[model samples]
Target chain A: MWDEKETDRKLCIICSKGTLDMAYPGLVLANAALMEGIDVTIFFTFWGLDMITKREMSNLKFTPIGNPHKMNFGNRTIGIPNAVAGFPGMTNMATSMIKKEMDKLEFPEIPEFLEMITDAGGKLYACRLSTDMFQLHEEDLYEGVEGIVGATDFMELSEDAQIIFI
Target chain B: MTSREIAGKTIEFDEDGFLANPQDWDKDVAQELAHEVGIDELTASHWQVIEFSRSDFDERGEAPTLRRLKVAAGVPTKDLYELFPKKPAKKIAYVSGLGKPHGCI
Candidate 1:
């Protein structure tokens, strides 16, 4: 019953987490929507602001503490206990493992992914409150970010649009 | 399997309107397909993308994603959007007579 030609669909993704694993879902979904000719906007808040933060975007860590899923490493599956996951270097280990898998699958890094989205005409925004709390400025974020806006502005921008929170 | 006449030849298309067989594609077919999608003409830049896509599909057995096009074909992302408009990935696949790209991003 959905008619794409008759309707201009829009998608708004709320990215609230900053983990390497979490950061990708929002970016991937935003890009997918753009590929479908849907208008897309991503709002970054809380730790999610790190996704747009220049210094931290590329170095996001994958914390294994709360992840219960097993990871596959070239025919070997490994599960890290919560205790072991908290140990030093575990985060780095997990991050690198996932990053390698992502690369093998041809997924780009976060900054490049953001660039792809921007090039496709997808809009990116940072939460003003979060920027203030994190002491981040416009200059501290990725150059492609359109603006740092409040919740109300986001609501207006995403009016009648389907929203996904990641 | 549905078929439509393109460039004076009856070409089979998948349920999604993509060419059922990549071998059925030709430059004239591409020009007609591009016109169906609101592209009045296929310029030299368009030919570059189409040629790259066809060769890439022959090697990979699947259509290339926008990222692959940008990285491997030396086409920039902005230029791809300009060439194909609203949905560059799907448009390129459609015009190139290949299956839709399966990558999420």
Candidate 2:
């Protein structure tokens, strides 16, 4: 028999990408879970560590290269070719466009989003090996990060919880 | 939808228990809703959030998200969690008789 009340629902989200588009999904999911009274833990590894690195968190970029979706500008849907998207300033342009759209929807910046999650009781952790590979220290991470932990520690922390990899 | 007697008045609720018609809310109904969600008493702090949410909903026709509550209503996110416990956004909306917040954040 299923016992809904006896089960304390939990969610563990693994963020492995650093791009601006990649970052928000994990964050938004974590925030939504916390809003619903579920326990949430987020693990940052690989390029995703950029999401918590103080120097890079706010400056994360979105690259439209290889993405086939057409971007809507006012009433027009324009698709950027891979070649054009790879031009020098294209990344910055794409990043700013995405940022503007996100702002219009009232999504907070990366650091502020992390603060909201932490304040709402969501847990954040950096993957130890990734931090070492990237030569990042505890001080380099956002203040809300709990700690740097290995895979095993993350497993223990996320025990009995549903897992999401982004 | 389901109907329940809360605070001596019959109230209609949606599938998730949010008020079907937000107009069917009053202070007494809010108190009972808060109690149903494990809040024993509606303290000044709790009422602060509830009142702000109701008025915000009235203007926007939607419940305020935690960020809106913090930025617009001047309630801190930390205080909201403490007041509403685990689910501040949904709890505040439920108690305020507003629809669920649609934004992911």
Q: Could you say which candidate leads in TM-score?
A: 1
How far off is residue A49 in model 2, in Å?
0.5
Candidate 2 residues lying further than 4 Å off, grouped into runs, are A1-7
- TM for candidate 1 is 0.95
Which residue pairs collide in model 2, if any? none
In model 1, which runs have C-alpha deviations exceeding 4 angstroms? A1-7
**Candidate 1, residue A51: lDDT:** 92
Error of 1 at B42 (Å): 0.4
Model 2 lDDT per residue over B1-105, tens place: 888888888989887668888998999998888887788999999998989888888898889889988888889889999998877787788888886667677
lDDT of 1 by residue, A51-161 (tens): 999999999999889888887676899799998999999999999989989998899999999999999999999999999999999999999999999999999999999
Q: How accurate is candidate 1 locally (lDDT)?
A: 0.89
